[model samples]
Target: MAPKITVIGTGYLGATHAAAMAELGFEVLGLDVVPEKIEMLAAGRVPMYEPGLEELLARHVAGLPGSTGRLRFTMDFAEVAEFGDVHFVCVNTPQKHNEYACDMSYVDAAFDSLAPLLTRPALVVGKSTVPVGSADRLARRLAELAPAGGDVELAWNPEFLREGFAVQDTLHPDRIVVGVREAGGSAEKLLREVYATPVAEGSPLVVTDFPTAELVKTAANSFLATKISFINAMAEVCEAAGGDVVKLAEAIGHDERIGAKFLRAGIGFGGGCLPKDIRAFMARAGELGADQALTFLREVDSINMRRRGHMVELAREAVGGSFLGKRVAVLGATFKPDSDDVRDSPALNVAGQVHLQGGQVTVYDPKGMDNARQVFPTLAYAASAAAAVAGADVVLHLTEWREFRELDPAELAGTVSVPLILDGRNALDAERWRAAGWTYRAMGRPRA
Candidate 1:
């Protein structure tokens, strides 16, 4: 018989995990403290926009795709403790207010609420990204809290699903890392069973000590952050040397040793993960008294931030120095395409900068307008890209959404007051826009 699984927390990670587990033929119950979240999930509507998450959830929750049983959602911890053989704590640990340290309160609360209910034998797995020493602390706490005490094992299984690709990444991960307290544990076996499809596809399964597993997530994010900053730093130098960073990245990316992924140079990196993870990693290093080793991340952070200011200055220049009374259209507001998540979004930051500089900036995004409104309500939002460009002096394409990429430069040139477009993301076709009777400017490109 398949082991019954309970997933605690129903945010992006937990919601997707619950749906995936049910799809894997396990009877799953998803739990959360928020009543509204549980209610929404039970009604078969995912609160956030993740591609294919809703379809998968509904298929399994309604017992459609050969499901052994339907998945359910509840706010009852006692029911979860009694029903599930294995529990997944998928809480979030966000960055604390005005500090580099992480706010672990959510993780602690999830464990505190559920650990005491594990009277019978069960395995409690952690999927939340946390500080290095967190797993050990939680393991000891779980042991003390449960009536079964040491019988209930604790394991750390960090998730690496990027937003917008969460469903596919979860269903078909590149590799699976399980941090167990000892060699040959049930945690690895259960996780293997949970990921049977990906395992069958030959995904590598690595088992390590608890601390190592905890550090794996932070280390991965920090390295990705470093990679993005590395290219942006090159972009700065390329700007000064009259060389194009895009061509340089393309040339260097051919070598398999440095295969291109996050090499695109633009306003720089931001999202729910990369920016805060590096800071939390730095804070953890400082707490461990090894701050000197990760000090270079500070430079990475600085370089990434400087790119934002540089783009603002570019916008200012495009609008003829002072932005007072200048009409500018800011295209795209989400940090990335196909995602509504805007936590520390670079596109919105650039839009806000133009607004602050007294430019009459009109912003438009395919899916991020609602979120952008919550973050920067002062900026003018347009109904569409055409509307945003209507009578504007210049257009700043900050986010590279597919719609923005496919925009007809001829149509946009006819709509705008001035035929000037600055490609902040380096994604636009300069030749196409120029041929359409508009002046196209892009970062890291030689000035026309």
Candidate 2:
């Protein structure tokens, strides 16, 4: 028989994990402390904008019409303890306020609440990204709290789901990593069985000790962040030397060794994962007395942040040296397209900065309006891109949404008071905008 699964904390990770497990043909239960979230998921609706997540949830969540009736939701941990053979903790570990360290309060509280309810044999798996050696401490805590004692086991299975491609990533992961204390424990066997389909379908499964598994997630994110910042650093040099970064990236990307994955030079990376994960990794390294080894990450962070300020500066320059009384139109608010998450969003950060500097900023995003409004209430918002650019002195393209790219530049040129635009993401077509009687300026590119 397949093991019944329960996902603790129905946020982005947990909600997607529960739905994917059900799609894998297992009975699943999802738990959350927030009634609103649970109620939303129970209705087969997701709280945030993630492509295909709601459809996946609607396909299996019990009580929904034409559903698989294999997934359910609950608020009680005791019910979760009773119903599941494998409990996956998918709680968030956000960065601490004004600090580089990750806040483990949510991860700790989830274990503290659920471990005491394990009265029967079960495998508790942690899917949250935490500091190294966290699984070791959590394993001990599980042993002390569970009434089943030796019958309950702990495993660490960190998640690597990207925001835009979360559903596909979960159903058919690129790799599956599990950290088990005991070499041949039931926890390992159960997880193997749970992921057998994906493994058989060609996803590699790597089994290792707890610390290595934990480091894998942080290391991968740091590498990606570094790759992004590396190109943006080149953009800085190009700007000083009057060179075009886009052509430079295209030339270098041809080398098979460099591989052109995250080489786009623009406003830099910002979202829930890359920014916080790198900072937390640095903090953890410092605690482990290896701070000097990762000092370059500080530069990586600085370069990334400098891009936002640079964009703001470029906007001010476009509007005659000051943001005062300049009507600025901002296209894109979420960090990236296909996601509504505004946490540490580069687009919103730039927009907020411009607003703070007194640029009468009117922002427009295809999907991030509500979240962006919550983040920056004082900033002006528009119903559409056309409305945003109407009577604007300058338009800033920050986030590269497909909708923004497909927009007719000629139509927008007719709306703005001054047909001057700055492409912060370097995603817009310079020729197309210039042909429409608009002055298109981008970082790292020579103005015609």
Candidate 3:
């Protein structure tokens, strides 16, 4: 028989994992400490803005009309312990308040709460982005706490879900990596069974030790951050040399060695993962006495953050070198498109800095207004892009949403007090804006 699954921590990762598990034909029970989140998921609703998550829940959540009834939710550790044969701990490992290390308090609390209740043989899988040695330490902790002792095993199966494509990514992962106590152990066998559907569908499964699995997520994030910062550094060079970065990126991308993915340099990378993950990676490396090996990550962090200030300065320049008495319009607030997560969003950061410097800023996002407003309550928020740009001294395109790209610049030409625009993402069409009777400027591009 297939193992029944319980997903702990019903945040973005936990909720999506539970839903995807149910969709794969398993009986899934999702647990969260927060009663409200449990209640929301039990009612087939998601607390956060993830595309297709609510619909996935509606289809599988028990008691919903026309649902498969394979999924459920609870806040009780006792119920979770008795119900699941395989438990997935999907808690968050956020960066520490004042330090660069990851805060594992939530993950620890979840394990401590659930471990004692595992009186039967079961496998506990960790899916959090944690420090490399975390799984080895946690494996011992689980054995020490569980009454079943050796019967309860541990595996590190870190999550790699992109914000916008989480559902699809979970349902059909490109690769399924599992870190077990030993190769061909019961934990690995159980995980292989759980993922048999995807593996059969061609998702390669890489079985490894605990530390390798734990390092995969942070390592992947650090590499991506480096890529984004590398291109942004080239953008800085392009600006100084009067070279067109867009054309340069296009030319270099043809080599297939560079492969033009993160090459569209703009405001650099931001979000929950990239910024803090690299910092935490560096901190963890330092603790392992390998700080010198990862010193370049500090420069990567510096370059990414510098892009935000550069955009702010460009906006100030567009407004005659002073933000005071200037009405700045900001488009998009989330870190990237398709999700309403505003954690450390470069767009909101730029907007907040301008607002603090005496600029009257109005912001608009297609799906991120509520979350963005919560993060930047003092900044004015508009109902639509047109409303945000109306009566503005200079318009700033910060986040590159499809709605922003599809915006008719000609229609917006008559709204602003001054027809000057700055493309922080370098995603907008320069010719379209310039032909629409507006002076357009973007980083690393010549102002023809």
- Per-model TM-score on C-alpha atoms: 0.97, 0.98, 0.99
- For candidate 1, list the clashing residue pairs, or say none: none
Candidate 3, 141-173: lDDT as tens digits: 999999999999999998889999999999899
Tens digits of per-residue lDDT for model 2 on 1-448?
9999999999999999999999999999999999999999999999999999999999999999999999999999999999999999999999999999999999999999999999999999999999998999999999999999989998999898998999999989999999998767788899999999999999998998999999999999999899899999999899899998888888999999888778888898998888999999999999999999899999999999999999998889888999999999999999989999998998899999988898899999999999999999999999999999999999999989999989999998888899998998888889998999999998788888
Q: Sort by TM-score, best first.
A: 3, 2, 1
Stretches > 4 Å off in candidate 2? none
lDDT by candidate, in order shown: 0.88, 0.93, 0.93
lDDT score for residue 414 of model 3: 90
Poorest 10 consecutive residues by lDDT, candidate 3: 253-262
Better of 1 and 3 by lDDT: 3
> Residue 342, candidate 3: how far off, in angstroms?
0.2
